[model samples]
Target: MLGIFDDLAAGNLAGVTESLARDVIYENPAGEQYAALPDSGVWRGREAVVEAFRRRAQLVDVLELQQRDVVAEGDRALVVTYQRIRHLLTGAEAGYEASALLSLDDEGLVRYWRVLSESAAEADVFDSDLDERLLAAVRAGDSREVGALLRRGADPNHRETATGLTTLQTAAGLGEATVVAALVAAGGDVHSADSRAGGTALHKAVQRGDLRTIRVLVEAGAFVDAVAPTTGHTPLMDALWYKWPDVVAYLLERNAGLGLHTHYGFSLREHFEYELNVNTRGKDKLLVAEQLLQTRTREDERAAGEQRLMAAVTEGDQAAVRGLLASGAAVDERFPVLNGFNDLHTPLLVASRDGHTEIVRLLLDAGADVNATEPTFGAVPLHKAVYNGHADITRILVERPGIDLDFQGATNGYSPLHDALWHGYEECARVLMAAGARTDLVGHDGKTPLDVATESFGAEHPLVRELAALG
Candidate 1:
């Protein structure tokens, strides 16, 4: 009976099946759920018992097994064993400590068996030096050495000295999938919570948008809805923060539950809206935020949608420009109450500064004043484009019929050509020149294009040479 228990622990299915009585019954937990034996159900008969063991084998490769304790009385035996099971594809291993009760008939063939496995604390396998070696291997991304050391009886769930991070948590936090896979292959506790943050590897993968790592963790049976301690943020929150739409979709597909909320009293969707509005300010940020908000909510979802759109136009999302216009979003939406960093500019001025040509075209097409000046810069779209060296957009703006080419803003006495030449935009200068920009124009510095070019780049540079050759 003791020998039969040893064979079963070793995953020697054939030996166990041969030794068991025809009426033997075996019981264990359901597949991929837990390690405990089924409470009520039992597999009856030798062939049925063999099939049960085979099904359990399919979940993980039994790399090694060692009996820690065994006691026998007559034909019955009880044994405790530590076993390592490796994930076939990722090579990640999970360790379990299990106790099995075996009953044998008069023929010395096992007749009944039940096994119960449970999770253990990290201190069970701690060795001071082995701990350091594992941490170093994980930090350096040394997958091979990590795997070998774990195989040599090193603990996969060893905690670091300073940070107290389990190897899995540290490796996953750094986005080192190789180290993570090796640790998992070595029977590391994938569900081990980080000492500091209480988040798991799955949380780390979600935060960084490492989709491959997420897939690996998930396939290794990591808890999908594992939440961080500090923020109570779930993997979904991490995905949304990093803008990983595909990861969000994948987690959702995996039946990941979503009661995730921040300490600020906001859900993941609301958090996304807040981040899109406040964290992102520039033109591109606003546009992406607008689209992102739409993905999370409906059109009549006014609070977030309106706020995002206002921020969008203020930052210059071209599609938002068209969408707002079509949907009657306020064109002159002002932020007078919140004055610091909240000064409002028309969408056209925002488009000009960011060099969003399509947005500029949309605003113009939607009846925006092309010559409207931003309050601070006092520069119109042409002045903004020329100042920023937006050569193509400047060309487009100047080429518009009935547009004022010589439009002078209040801040600078210089025309569009003066701004172009001062900014060293040779291509813009050429375009302005081709558009009949004045060669004799003088700026606030009392210098022409040739003078500025010669002073800035020396007469030998192409810019100065082009200006000098223009004569």
Candidate 2:
């Protein structure tokens, strides 16, 4: 199965065609539209299947199958695939969740091939001159061409049968306001559901973070609260996940639901907070926080402060870091109970782990304990800096008074030097050695730095020479 996927991804047609039986039955009931079209059908025989594929190449610029699962039982396999297509004629794109059942002969040739998909609306094998021209115009953002096509009797709401996407959906997804406005003026339906996940143009706009195109659709009577029937995702929820502040603000102004639970079972506020906490963009942190504040009730203030501080450290926002510290954020505040970090991280540990040298300096200057150990790993901030090969951070920690150079972490498994050697951090190892890191010290396994160095890179490597010189 993996070999078949590899062949398909690489466009190895011979590899694909050679594995099919001479009289194989390729039955695609969902592709009935293609049965009436030229050179397309429930192809029989290896020769007919190869010809069907040759015809398929005419309409597609790109075809990719993202494999999700493959379950095999003897000679039969049930395969789940996500199909992405870029049409050559329309220059439009579409994706579908597809399932296929295959029967392979004892000789490993495919004998019976059957397929099922979520919707027949996404069956895009049928093609015409007008359909391609209309979609190409829409995708290119050519408002004049789109208007011309509409006047010449093109369907303003014409959907790519394979992707279940209308011209408006593609325009909105691409953030083309001019094209969206042109289609809207020509009677495009803003609320039409797509075949894949039943998403409308508004959903696509929000998903793409296109404020301008979103406005055009909203003004054309697109619903702000419209949830995708398949995914149950509102445009607001999509905007929140993407960290689009302006989109979130606009949806809020339009009375979009704030506390709606996502498909993941978390409320919008919880998802926004998670996004804010994990985001590494400094400026975006503030914007997302402000959006959260606007939507958050007074009960969310306490947790909001901690999230803000953590976000600042995550982004290496020096100013926000100083401000949060000045405004009474605890220097050693613990990460929340369920934040998914393997260790309980303070701001200093987080900064050092992220290689934020300036933030690490700031946190240290603001009274962050350099030797403070994470509760889970029993590892200090310097251990993290060494593990991540932060040379500047290693220098900074070593320069500080009372800093432990050979602190054994987590039942004394790997000292900082041992970790540096094991992970091939030669520069950090050199820095640690220069800062009076003991060459005689061994880890819990009784292996010295030189032993680790010789084992990791052999005695001939430069690291062994450095560690030996330290002794």
Candidate 3:
């Protein structure tokens, strides 16, 4: 019976099926989850049990198999063994202490087998002697020992003791240029992936902005376009995501492609644009990124330009806006894709929303339409200024000639007065009303500004009660 099981483990699926009794049954430890078995959810029957072992064998290259103990009772047998599972592609090894409850038929062939083993997380089959020595040398940056070990037939691509990372990947991640060079020189696979994260040395170098390590890996033939398994992000994408200009340039010079899609379906160009508009940096960084992005294809350049404009507007950087305009940035630039609404924001509306008095004045002086309504929100500069409680800017916009103070948002039908009252901006609300701003404007929900204030503040606060009383 034990010999039959050994034959099965050796990949011979011959006459063992016919020897199993038709009434055989198998049982496993409670709550054990086998990857091959259906969650239905326990193991049962003879053929189904054998199929499970076959599937497990398919995922691993078994280097060695050894049985530790065997106990037999009547027609049943229990066997414990250790199996080494090596990942065929990456050469990673994992071990499992396997226990099988087997029921044999009268003819000496296995009838049913149920395996209760430690879960995958507990499996580690790699030889520790080589791993411990290599990590010690690599971490101490002892190139001599590293070289000697490699020459002595130690695996150069062995992972670190702490992080389960390849020596080259760890060196690059830690910015250890000497160790990286040594490992590369010792025939370490530059394209070797970290055992845990599946990232190559180039990916770590790009992420840490380690220019020296990046160059080393690139020179050693590491794939600059290698993407992380977790993120599906290329090395170039990682650099762009983190705003690492030097890494980006190095990878690009090596022809690292940037058009790869992340797991989130965003390209490297899109990530840069999103960061440019969303990050809290000042105009200088945005401008620098814009200049770098301009070196890309025409479509990417145009997208970056639009993002630059959005950043300038969102951050209220008057100087950046002026400088971009002076450098021939298009004043009427709009986003390429808008689901339904057109993109019609002028610099005035941007400045007014962000409370930038100087930018608003500058855009107005630059002949921007003061009363132009945004296509999505449908609010002019005056409406946004009034709603956001920029009283000084609002006062300037409302008092300007030909600017309408009663403009409403197209989507929500919210007037500037409603917006101010809802957000507890008393001074802006009072100033708008004092300047002949309509107080009775209703939103899409059939509630006026005073009604909103009453509902929110319960008409208890002096200012809220006062606004409600004005109705």
Candidate 4:
């Protein structure tokens, strides 16, 4: 039995023929390879079996085969083998554990063999037991329990798959100082941002206005100047946005990056000034404004560089982009646009919308937010690129790491995928789907990207076919 399995695994078809009887019967289940090769099933003779293997070789490549366990009783042996196969044309991989039943004749020659299929694929297997336990401990704020679990081999950086929130982040937001410490000591990732908002545990602490928890996290060495994933709002900006005077002062004292800009192009100092001017609150507002503006003189030195970068980006000048970045301009500098000229004007967004692929790469390399949304309508660079029918730019944005592919714009909650299909950008839609864009994301009008594609192009259209394939 082992010799037969080895012969097949080594591509020794002639050796396999010598082992089998001249009139041996070999059979693969219906639909095993019939979709690609009709003559692959049920071979009557040893020569026919060899022909079936030859046809199968044309369709797929067996990447791996592992013997699991074998049982032998009388003249029969049951052998389990795990096989990983990759399709030649589509490059799709499927792994399954197969049980082969063999009946042997005298002289250790195989007469008949039958292979059974497994119900589950290797890729579909996942063990989330430890993750569930870690989440439960963190959520319950049981520091001792969490510490024990971590020591017992639970992942300190385990994230809730749906929300992408880490255990430390959850504890920080819930003001569980002890749990936060336990997680941090266990090597919890302090830098990972939540998938949805792109904010770190520090941001979560600020959102809850928990100063003690914030102190615990800061002492644990969180990134003080960490920006939100989608909006690029720093901890200081988050404190100001929520009107937490004490938290704002704490962050400012820690030298939180003073000039970081929001997705809407508002700086922390500028946001404070805007709030001061809008409200009638007297002393507190005046004090916060004075403290924040103390660093204005330093920011003024970079003002000229920012202006040049913004001008070059608006014009889609790749050369200017390279020069300005080298001249100390912040990579994600935002400038106020004229009224009715769009709310956000970051270099990346502008270059992407203008279909400047080179400039887009330069800005992304300079740490521009690929998923940063415009403050007015909450559209990211991907949305702008798709709306303008820049298929190349769309492909680049979708391939970027940490890009929110299914983010719904504030305009109508329509994702970039929906925008691409709605505008008839068939190539852009294909690129997005290929990069794992969620086709079932429903917009405000309760329509998926597929629905929009089907409505714009018929069901048989390429766009519809691509989306249907994703399903």
Candidate lDDT values, in order = 0.68, 0.76, 0.69, 0.75
Alpha-carbon TM-score of each model against the true structure: 0.34, 0.36, 0.35, 0.37
CA RMSD (A), model 4: 19.7
Candidate 1 residue-wise lDDT, 136-255, digit = tens: 887788887777567656687877657767878788877887777777887878788878877888887777767778888989989777777788787877776776777777776664
Candidate 3 stretches greater than 4 Å from native = 1-128, 160-162, 281-287, 298-471
Total clashing pairs for each candidate: 6, 1, 1, 1
Query: Pairs clashing in candidate 4?
Result: 198-229
Q: So what's the TM-score on candidate 4?
A: 0.37
Evaluated at residue 406, the lDDT of candidate 4 is 89
Model 4: per-residue Cα lDDT over 1-471, one tens digit each: 587666766767788778887777776565522223323356787788778777665656678778899999988888899778666544667778888787778767777776655333422221124456678888887777777667656787777878788878888888887888778888888888888888999999988888888887888778788878688788877777666767876776665656567787787668767766786755574566456546443444455344788778778788988998887787776654222343345778878888999989988888898987766577889999998899999878887889998899977989989999899988888888888888888999999998999998999986688778777
Give lDDT for model 1: 0.68
TM-score of decoy 2: 0.36
For candidate 2, the C-alpha RMSD (Å) to the true structure equals 20.4
Question: What's the true lDDT of residue 64 in model 2?
Answer: 75
Per-residue lDDT of 220 in model 1: 97
Off by over 4 Å in 4: 1-176, 179-212, 215-246, 250-289, 293-307, 317-319, 322-346, 357-384, 392-419, 430-452, 455-462, 465-471
lDDT of 3 by residue, 1-471 (tens): 677556655766454445455555555444323222222134456576556446555545677678989998998778898866674434667666778787766677666666656545323322224455676777787877776666645576776657868777766777777778877887778887877777888888777787988888888878777777877888877777667777766666665654567777677777777777787855454456556655644544466455676568668787897887677665555433222222446667767887898777766666667787876577877777867789888777777778777777887888888877777777887778788877788899998877877865676877666666667
RMSD of each: 21.9, 20.4, 17.7, 19.7
Any idea what lDDT model 2 has?
0.76
